[model samples]
Target: MRAMVVAAVVIALAAASPVLAETVACHLTYGGETQVIESAPLASPYAGTPTAIGSFFLFRIIFVREPADLARINLYVYAHAEFGEAPTPVQHASYPYPVSNHGRYGFTGLQRVYEPKHESELQYWCEMRGA
Candidate 1:
């Protein structure tokens, strides 16, 4: 009976603990190809790096989990040249914590962005799992 009580207490504590592991996966589609980028929430927004997509775009997703009120996710898309020219910011999207998923699921739905110079289209959607 004592062992059973201890086991119950342990289970209760575990259930009350906060979820420290979360994954935010983004599906990126461009130029007839698709790519997925998965990331866990970071303590700092500056910890993320951009990934090159094809010859014209650099994409980045940053998830920051701080205080409950301050948690957020930011997506950045940049227009980049294969040459030595600098990358120019094209699109930026910010989603606050507990994103607007009415009842469907964790998916945030499809979002379309465009590059200013070439007017190229980039499509992406993101799903968040865990807390």
Candidate 2:
């Protein structure tokens, strides 16, 4: 019984480790269709540019602050839409954060994107700061 409990604890810690390692997070949503994101893009330490969209349905990202971080959470979004001419983004939001940055902080995020018109060739890039 003790061994099973310990194993469960180990798995929980392993799952939470990734959130502690990151400083930025994001969320993206589309109006329709389900989609899949290939990998997590690193916004710091290295430059990331995901600009390749082909036969895409929908892709989005969402982020939240880990309880341990104890800092303001920020989110970023990068997406491309498909269309006869070009997918026009309908809206953009600039939400506010409650407190100031705690210096060393991290975030976790996911994205949802959609490409109905083109259904192909939908890609983009974005970042966030001072959540």
Candidate 3:
């Protein structure tokens, strides 16, 4: 009976623990382009300044691939506004476990929360990093 209990406890523990899988290719679409970012380190085409969008800026769009039967992806979106001075982060949001049925996802129309007083340019970028 004791042996059986021990075996049951071991089985339970094993089931409770999550299994880590190898990193896979994940794609992020921003600024009319799609780039591949691995699960190892964050990677993106927009490494430097953020891209421009009218008077607002797109900070970044990062996608982290998850270990699931389907193409489950975690999407991270960030945006900021600049008014001649240093840029300030306006928005930061995350969508967890977004299933990518077509192996692709796109996000747009990120409205800037802060409005600049004078004529300013909006900058943005995208990146992919480890989950």
Candidate closest to the true structure, highest lDDT: 1
Better of 1 and 2 by TM-score: 1
Every candidate's lDDT: 0.82, 0.36, 0.41
Let me know the TM-score candidate 3 reaches against the reference structure. Answer: 0.31
**Local accuracy of candidate 2 as per-residue lDDT tens digits, 1-131:** 99999999999999877553332332222333323333342334223433223333323333333333432323333334435554345223332323233333312222234444444332233344432
Residue 49 local lDDT, model 2: 37
Best by TM-score: 1
Model 3 lDDT per residue over 1-131, tens place = 99999999999999998865434333434445545544432243223334444434443434444333333333332334345665556555544444222312232222223334543433222232223
lDDT of 1: 0.82
Model 2: residues >4 Å from true position, as ranges? Answer: 1-22, 27-84, 97-131
Sorted by lDDT, highest first, which candidate order results?
Answer: 1, 3, 2
C-alpha RMSD (angstroms) for model 1: 3.7
Cα lDDT tens digits, model 1, 1-131, are 99999999999999999866677888899998999988888888889899988777889988887877878988898988647888898888888976655333245578787877777888888888665
Clash pairs for candidate 1: none
